[model samples]
Target chain A: MDFATLIQILDSTVRLATPLLFACLAGLFSERAGVFDIGLEGKMLAAAFLSGAVAAVTGNVWLGMFAGIGASLLMAAIHGLASITFRGNQLISGVAINFLAAGLTVLLGQNWFGLGGRTPALTSGGRFEPIILPFAEAMAPVPVLGPIYSELISGHSFPVYLAWAMVPATAWLLYRTRFGLRLRAVGENPAAVDTAGVSVTAIRYAAVAICGVLCGLAGAYLATGLAAGFGKDMTAGRGFIALAALIFAKWRPWYALGACLLFGFLEAVGNRFPNIDLGLIVLPAQFMQALPYILTVVILAGFVGKAIPPRAGGEPYVKER
Target chain B: MTAMPKWADAVLVPLISLLIAFVISGLVILAIGENPMEAMRIMVSGALGSTYGWGYTLYYATNFIFTGLAVSVAFHAGLFNIGGEGQAGVGGLGVALACLYIPWPHWSLALAAALVASAVFGAAWAAIPAWLQAKRGSHIVITTIMFNFIASALLVYVLVNILRPTGSMDASSARFAEHLRLPRLNEILALVGIPFNNRNPANISFLLGLVACVAVWVLMWRTRLGYELRAFGKSEKAAVYAGISPVKITMAAMLISGALAGMMAVNTVMGEAQRLILNSVEGAGFIGIAVALMGRSHPFGVLLAALLFGFLYQGGAELALWTKIPRELIVVIQALVILFTGALDNMVRRPVETLFLMARKGR
Candidate 1:
């Protein structure tokens, strides 16, 4: 491919990978804290709908984002109540949240907007626009670095930058903070963490809440930054895809970025070429779309490597027991 | 420490949970400016009032029965097996190919062939995931879920390129020949001199589902393999110590589960639609999970749970058509039912057990 084509593909990859990055980071927190959250998709969908609906009504994107985070937090709280407080099955609770979000978003959206489960399209102030850097225009005349600076690194919606910044923030928080150490311990051995005077329940709840915030941002970005409005089940299966990426990355923040980018690059290539011809045969676009999932299965099957989850993940903590 | 009778534990808990779910759903209806009582009445009349309603309800139940049985079989062997959706989808392809390519003299023979073809196809789809989990230590849940999406994409490719009738705008294949169509419920009932709804889509596959339920019951409770499967599920390490191969049990359970899920296609593609189409499964696979959970993963319980969900589904359609309530609200109701019955079971069970214990102590 030509330089322009390559640049376009990389741009699409950045846009696509941003949401996955946020979601992967979100799952990393919850899973690392001993709470398995398959409900990331549901939280993101709820956030996407709330953000789009609120932004349309208030004409303020920032308010929309806050509302989105609040909605996601509500879902996270319900999940925590079910899995942590009630001591219910974690996977079942996650599935329930997904169903709830899928239904409630469409039901409420249809009732309020009367647009068949879709919010009103956003205008300038209601959506995130791409911001160009100051040096982009001035550096355009330089040959190789010019296009890389202006095209690759410069223009993107605000969430794209936030998602990238979160990678280092997550790493530092996970490795450097006392709370992070406790959280990691809780996931591996809650009894040990409890013996150390940490409240396992509290740490897990906090992790879920943090997950809620990240997922909310991811959803808000999808609704306001990527698309102009929310549609029913707009998150599609990205939440699941993000889970696969989490496994692919071995639950590390830096590796999560790499996995998301790789998956995003695959998606970009699929979108660019609907049908790819090789010397012997042509490959359908669907194969590329399904590649991440296929690869996840392959990786999990030990063809590539092993993916070990947190030791105490998916088990409800019982302090007395 | 026995707090309640076995019968009450089996029946009372689910009934109480269902009641609670409906009460909450009623409030949700009221919030939408609709009369909850009126909505209930409409749902009851729409889903169970007439022969036509029963036909649709039974048709939906038939689909659920297969998927539920599929899930239950896997659950018995300690496998989650959430790939029922994909298995059923591929089963539809099997049904379609059998109907389109083969020249059958009668519907009965065609039905048998289709059943075999679907079971094989579905089993093949599930085998890879099962093998991964059994031998490679891959988590079955993630792999099965991934397979669901891959199955959907695969179905799309086959339908769009290979199965579509020449020059047809739709993505479905041509309808099966006249003799290849399974006999409708009305036709079967008519032979016994009973009046039935001819317009509804329920057909002979309901009988097939009933037969399959009985077969599953016998296999699970009466047979040695079933004992081994359950033992493996209860404690894999113990079973291994007792000389039962973990890989063998996992593969056997998953294959049975996949075959049952595949049987759902006989109802939708052969009996109802008479043509293979995209979305023929229509989330029945996921619904099966709830059914299996509610039924406690037993064949008889699965049958009842499938019937209950069928009522909800048919009734929900009526609510959407007659009232301002959106169709998606049914999904919320289903989720709440699942939350209460499966996830939040201890919430009700603990209170009831305490009450029973107190009563026994007083006596």
Candidate 2:
């Protein structure tokens, strides 16, 4: 690959990885608070549809973002209600939410827009236009770092920067804040958090809500930033991939960015090179697409390294008499 | 240990949950400017009113029965095998390879060969995750979900590059030989002097599904392995104390679960399509989760739940064709059912148990 092609791939990688970064961070918050959320995919889908639908109708990108976030939050509330209040199986709840989003998004989309389970294509006014950084055009004349800064980092939608910014923000929230300490405590041992006069339920609910907000942003980015409109199952398995990225990152915020970027780069390569010729052997595009999932499985199998989830993950906090 | 009567636990809770799910589904329909009652009527007549409807319904039920049994078997061993989709997909590959490559003297022998091959393939697909869960301490749920994606990618590659006939535009394999086609249900019923629809895809695999149900029932209840599986599911600590190997049980149950899921290929690929098609399994593997949940993971309950879902599927198809309602409405209903029955069981159970106890006290 030439330098331009390399820059092109990196540009797409930044665009593609933004959604995963958002979702991985979302999972980080919820799982850190002892809630294993597999419904991240569902929430993202629902948000994508709603945001796209709203943006198409109102012709406002910000409104679309809020609509997307609201849709995700509703699903998150349902997950919270099922797994926390009812003390139900968190995985099952997550599965149901996924199905619900997959079905409801299309169903409502068809009804609202009559476009066969797709939102109407958003115009430029409804979509998130790429923000050109200061001196990007001027810097392009220089060599090496100039093109890199201009082509790869400067020209992206606001969410791209927001997603990158969130890595540091999440790291600080997780490691520096009092609420962060309490949230980590609840995930590791809710009983102790409860004994300390903190409400385990409240902390978990807050964590889940934060997760919803981040997922909402991710979905909105997919629909309004990366793509023009909402398509049926547009989120595809990105949510699950995000979950995989979370595990690959060992649930750390900064590592999540790296994992997502790695997955994104793989996706970009799959898009750029449909088939790769390795002299004696030819690698198919399907193999390229499957690489992230395969790598995740290998990571999960402990060949690379062991990934331990939160200690109190997936368990509902039950008070003993 | 029990708060309510067995019958109520078995029947009443599901009924209430189903009712709630249907009501929500109805409201969704109403929100879409369609008449919920009319939709219900259309679904009923479309899926169950005629022999043709029953044919399609039973055909779908055949797929569900196999997949549901797969989930139930693993559920008994306290493992969630959501990889049914991937397993079933790989199983189709087995069925296709057996039918396409091997020349059998008779359809019976061909089916037998295909059944074994599919089971083996499906079990092999599930074995890695099962082994990981049993030995390496990897979460089966996550691994299985990842496997689903990998399985799809594998299927796409095999179909496009390896299985597709030369010059064919579609990514499906070549059709099976005329003689190898399974006997349709109508033909089978004609021998018994019963008139049935000849056009629908329902076939002998429906009978095989029924037989698998009985086989699963026996394996789950009548066998020592079944007893150990349930015991391990109930209390892993106690089972370990009693000398039952967790690794052994986990591997055995997942393999059986995968095999059962794999058998669904016999119905979809061998019986209906008579060829290996892309996405032939569709969402039946995921549907198995809802079926197993609604049926309480029992073989008999799986049968009833499978039939119900089969009805919903057929009816929803009809509704989509005739009305403004989308076929995805059925998926929404399935989601609601899963949400209520699987995740919010205690919501209805607690209230019902209290009511039952109050009635008993009054009596």
Candidate 3:
């Protein structure tokens, strides 16, 4: 409740929100291109496991991150092949991808590590080290802005800053670029885009691939930046939470940052205060954990506001038909 | 006219998909430096070789049967109800409350009351999402996913704060009274002079599951409502023009799905544990999706798919216990099965249909 505690909570918020930010942006890209991706969680989980394992084995976080991305991309390719190429049920494909990553990660982890589906603990070089901003020490002497700068924004690992930076970059890419215009058009009405000579399939595949890369970053952050290594099901429904954040943000980039940060703040508050007794009704931490999902459902039911999806979303484009 | 025989559509397509899934699963095993053939042998023997194995398999199958049927009923109504896990969890809570609070004089009366309680609770959990989907245009898939998390949170709160016995470390309800516990399957078998495994968790709920499958078949195929539901599913605009209320069909189908999902709790919570515990549903709800997909949304198909999964589950446990292969291998197989049968059906179907066409033309 105090300033220092508030700063501390915000610090953890930045850390926790980093993964959600990456994932929300990922979903935004895919859903905006007419491909509904519920497999974000699975991709993140696979990436987390692969990154953690590779980091532990090779003692290189960058290699770990790439390995994670590769794993996610492989799954994304499978999703694209099924839902895009074969015109399969997108939701079912997502569900299968989730199950596939979940099973394969633990099975491979147990077989390789022999430690009950967990990678080896990440060493110093295997993990992302917190980088101190140049003026953090100097800023610590100032009154109001000091702790906010030094504690809240200056000491997070690289991904936290990168995740924040991606918000604007994604906004620019989505709203100001020609590719983005075509992508939005494809999602809204693929037939028009196809008639205009833009390949809907190509645009969708690109979006899904972008989705895979962002999910990879999210997973890598969880493994090497947030925690020291991967644990089984370590993403732990964060992908779904990111999906909720996407809806809460109305599939926009800047709003996605706000949504992820808000959800992250709730998690931080929950962690800090496990149980809160208000003299009458006590609130459990589970409420905080479930808040994002509950709020999204409310938004979805149009209680707060309507959150409409892209018109052509979840439908495969069949040119001849 | 259909391009292929009805039997091929029903049987051949799924079989081919299953074969491809198994082959891919075998390759995965091989990649891990394990012999897929040996693993298959172990699974087959471990799950089907002994009475004990069959007991566990049947018990797990009972849970699947209920959840699978739940998914199938919804599929027929053109609704994808993936909230089976949450519904089943709430149903377990209902079962626990019914057993703990109700002072039933006999077990039969207790079972009946518990069944109704669970179905009601499960359906109630599903009702909000169904209503939103029906009236507000909310996607059922997303809403149900959110509800699953809400149900989990609710279960944790109830178990930890309300149901847990004082001074207990675990978050679970107190055990039900001894006489209230359902009879084990072996106990019933012994009454008829048939021998079976006595120590396994298999119980009378398995029989109830079989009965429910038959009931579902009757409800889905032999009833007027089923026709309306199927008609609505096939083409909503057409059904509307033909005088079917979309709202009514949506609510009815989801409610039936929810109730069927809820009944899975009878097998897990009442028959096996005799106490409600956190995570009692334990992914069986999701497994129902795979079962329904593989079974093509038919009750009899659901039964077979459920049994196959039950075998995988029991066999995977044995594999994990004995070999280097983990139990999650079964989940991988399940994913592959879903991918092939549900998502990538056209990958196999197209080639098969073409083959049939070519053969007919040649003839």
Which candidate should be chosen as best, given lDDT against the real structure? 2
Identify the runs in model 1 with alpha carbons over 4 angstroms from their true place. none
- Label model 2 with its docking quality class: high
- Write down the DockQ of candidate 3: 0.89
- Residues A1-321 of candidate 1 have per-residue lDDT tens digits of 898899899999999999899999999999999898889999999999999999999999989999999999999998888888888988878888888899889989988888989999999999998889999999977988888889989999899999999999999999999998998998999999998888898999999999999999999999999999999899989999999999999999999999999999999999999988996988998888889999999889877778888999989999875
Tell me how candidate 1 scores on lDDT: 0.91
lDDT for each residue of candidate 2 in A1-321, tens digit (9 for 90 to 100): 799899999999999999999999999999999999999999999999999999999999999999999999999999999988999889999999999999999899999989999999999999999899999999997888888989998989999999999999999999999999999999999999999889999999999999999999999999999999999999989999999999999999999999999999999999999999999999999999888899999999999989998999999999867
Write down the DockQ of candidate 2.
0.89
CA displacement after TM-score superposition, residue A263 of candidate 1 (Å): 1.1
lDDT of 3: 0.94
Off by over 4 Å in 3: none
**B1-363: candidate 1 lDDT, tens digit per residue:** 578999879989888988898898888888767899998898899999999999999999999999999999998998888899999999999999998899999988999999998999889889999999899878788888899999998998888888998999999989999888788999999999999999999999999999999999999999999999999999999999999999999999999999899889999999988999988999998888889888989899999999998988899899889988888988988888878887888887889998889888899
Across B1-363, the per-residue lDDT of candidate 2 in tens digits comes to 577999999999999999999999999999999999999999999999999999999999999999999999999999999999999999999999999999988999999999998999999999999999999999999999999999999999999999999999999999998899999999999999999999899999999999999998998899999999999999999999999999999999999999999989999999999999999999999999999999999999999999999999999999999999999999999999999999998888999999998988899
Stretches > 4 Å off in candidate 2:
none
Better of 1 and 3 by TM-score: 3
Judged by DockQ cut-offs, the docking class of candidate 1 is: high
Q: What is the overall TM-score of model 1 with all chains considered together?
A: 0.98
Q: Which candidate model has the greater TM-score, 1 or 2? A: 2
